[model samples]
Target: MASATVDSGGIGRASLFLASGTIVSRILGFVKLIVLAGMIGAYGDSADAFSIANQLPNTVYVIVAGGILTAVLVPQIVRASQHADGGTAYINKLLTLALLILTITTVVAVALAPLITGFIGLNLSSDQLALAIAFAYWCLPQMFFYGLYTLLGEVLNARKSFGPFTWVPVLNNVVAIAGLVVFAIMFGADPTGSRSAGEVTPAMVAVLAGSATLGVVAQALVLFYFWRRIGLRFRPDFHFRGVGLRATGRMAGWTFGMLLLTTGAGIAETQVATLATGQASVFVLATAWLIFMLPHSVITVSVATAYFTRMSEHAALAKFDLVKTDASSAIRGTTLLIVLASAVIAVCAYPFAAVFVSPFDQIVGIGNVILAFIVGLVPFCVLFVLQRTFYALGDTRTPFFFTLFQVVLILLGVLGCTQLPVEWIAVGIAGVITVSGVLQAALAAVLLRRRLGGLDGRRMLQSLVKYLTAAILPVLLGLSLVWLLGGTQQGGFAVSGRFGAIVSMIAVGLVMASSYFGMLLLMRSAELQAFLTPLRARLRR
Candidate 1:
């Protein structure tokens, strides 16, 4: 049963499809990580150095063109196309501004990468430092290409054409992988090739690095073609030049401020990991992150696309009631999905972790220890979905403020926890991150309700109760089945002997998911209807 409140915007549908696309992208991204980790190994100082060295350049790209650009540009493009009356002209102005900013930023980033790397001194070996430097130079072109692609993607999204945007990463990964493959082939043929994979031969590293940058170029070109197909013209309009920069600058301030705070939180986590003995902290953090992002990729990113689209439409219509209803539905759907995903992760943590680190288990150890913190990832998933929903509503500042507060809490908690002599600082850091996320989500939810003129709190609570009932039964049954089948021990259950465990897990998951939907539908929960309708249609085939 749908809610009594009307939803004029197709938020529910958009979220579902968006999440599906995100899942595809995230899976490819995951595969990329696995391959990279296998190649780089896990525990060595060289790998550590590579991670740290790439961090700044990656940060520069994300802040200047990736996150900040996506967060700010999407809404503006939505407004300009949908409601600003100037329409195509407005979009052209936005694109021009984006180009100008990207050009300046890329030039600046390339110049700064070396000086910053030297100053930070991430304790890389001479070879590692050189590779890092090469990687930085290779990453520069991405700033320009990503900015263009992001603008085009945002335009497609605003026009409610998500199919093309969703597959853009497929193009990116294919190009990137091809480049890497070619670079490896070239390197392996070189006379100096036998000098260890980790040894950064300038020629080899430069080839790999340069190829990476070229991949981004390839990505942008594909997206540009799609943009043209969708009726976008690449006009370098200087019409709004002077004033446009100023407006963009103003928005950039807010965008960068939020990014800076979030980046600080990331840095804080890294620093804490650094304090731990060996790479245990990094391994755990990375493993937990991989698990955590699965749900986020599915739930949050999916919901964000729908939310952003609906909010843009609703803002145009001044349909506050519809806006509120759509927002509530997005939250409800995202929350329920996360709960389900958390249950799945909890059950499958060991197997999933094993697969992730299979090729490099020696370097990182068996990854099961990171499962301790996987539970804490539930709230983090919820927070990510909620934050994206808020941002989509053009209320980005609210999340910024809440994230700042959360970071404060994290800093204090981590600072205090480190003094306690825990062996796995990653676990302690996980606790802090979890706590911070929950706090932020709680605060944001309150603000969101206020913004929406109060959500159906009692109704939402009742739905949550039904969901909890549906979720718990399957989890318990699955756990019991796993325990009887030799538990989640790595060596105890051979894949041959443990077919029962796999079968039982599948059975339990299906049963639980079905039961959860049944309960929600029986309770007349709008969220259940929103989710199950599409699934039911697919199942009908």
Candidate 2:
């Protein structure tokens, strides 16, 4: 039997599920942005209004919505499922509490929207401000439903019912896209004809807001349907007097602490970025954020989903060896993924810039300059996966402390970068942050290893060498391709028109992916075999 491992069973299955969901969500999110960009156009008061209003609600979403969904609720569901609770009671109680919290938060948010926009969004015009308030109200209400949806998802994941969970985000994105199309029709045009009346007012920024609300409603309904199909039944239990209250309070307390730290660091980064001279430079920062977050979305969340489930499975079966092996595999897998991605990005970076940067030049001329810094962070970004490893071992404080330290380093780095030219500032910050990330990961690995007690260090190091060797070949090939293809000259891949950058990026991405795969095959790395075996099984299916 080769000693059945968590990697071979539920956790692996759940990870693939979450990964697939994330891919779907990311693709749809990309589409949604494209639609939004076309509808709003670039560089105007409307765009500014949408951006500011959206950020306000999103910040709340992250702090409140995401805090519970990822940290508190998911862990609780996993624990409940481990003891053969099958998730019903835990799901009901968590959802009930989440609804209560979300409703209260939404009310407070709506009332305070104007105040928030006034303080944080001081740059917007009157129309922009009105739109922001409307959008905030529309989207704010979703916090309640999504809180329940998140609970359902966590329960499904804990139950190893990942297929359902995976499809939910895709469904959510679909609704969002649909709403965008309708909003465009209703709003009439960017100048105001495209507005659909009740669909979303073009004159109001709430069109974007309405789309978000509709999407959440649709997503929540679908999740609820699936929850029912999965045999989950819930009754409201609002009394916070005993076990439920204690559990909810503890989870919320932990999650809020963690969320505050994370959100505070993000806010600091933005503040520092804003202090830079050029206005367009902020777009550069935003674009960098968009690009880096693609991988962060796919890798970090997928691994966390897997880690949490695997930990529960191991605890249930009393299979310590399997647990350790699965944990080690996860660490190695995520680390290699980060390394390979960084290498590829670093190698073909200039070509990618030529293919993707020019179009955004109108809003951001220093796009290519920022791309370098974005690539620089890839090395450190892998450490994000370390948080999953810690969480799996029932530790979260390590991540909190490590994150705080990194934030301090980032603040210092940004302050130092301001002394340099604007062009170098982004790069300098990226370099400092990346290096700090590496240090953080090293320290985390040390601490985690000591706490958990076993991690195939010797094999891990050997695998790293093999992985690096395999990665080097493609990087070399990619560099040659870029050099041969004009190497950052004015317009080798064509920079004009609506589809030029899109086509070029697609072509380059495909070539890079193919070449990287071929190189891995030639090396016959063990990691390649692991990926292939699972894929082969899926093919048989």
Q: What local distance difference test score does each model get?
A: 0.62, 0.60
**Candidate 2: RMSD over Cα atoms?**
4.9
Q: What is candidate 1's local distance difference test score?
A: 0.62
Residue pairs in clash, model 1: 19-302
* Top candidate by lDDT: 1
- Tens-digit lDDT track of model 2 for 1-541: 0111135455555666677777888778767766665665433445545555556555676678675466555555666664456655656666787777778887897888788665554444465556656666666677666766676776766665666555666777787788778767865445311322233454445556777777777776777676676677778876645344465565556656667766665555544444442333333445455555666667655765667677655644566666667666766666556556666555544444333333434422444444545554534444654565555544556677776777677767767877876555555665666666767777776776676676676787787777667666666666666555544455544243335545544555567667766777887767777778988998999
Whole-model alpha-carbon lDDT for candidate 2? 0.60
Error of 1 at 180 (Å): 4.8
lDDT (0-100) at residue 175 of candidate 2? 78
- 127-198 in candidate 1: lDDT tens per residue? 655656766666666778777777787777776677566666766666656655675566443221123335
At residue 142, candidate 2 shows an lDDT of 72
How high is each candidate's TM-score?
Answer: 0.83, 0.83
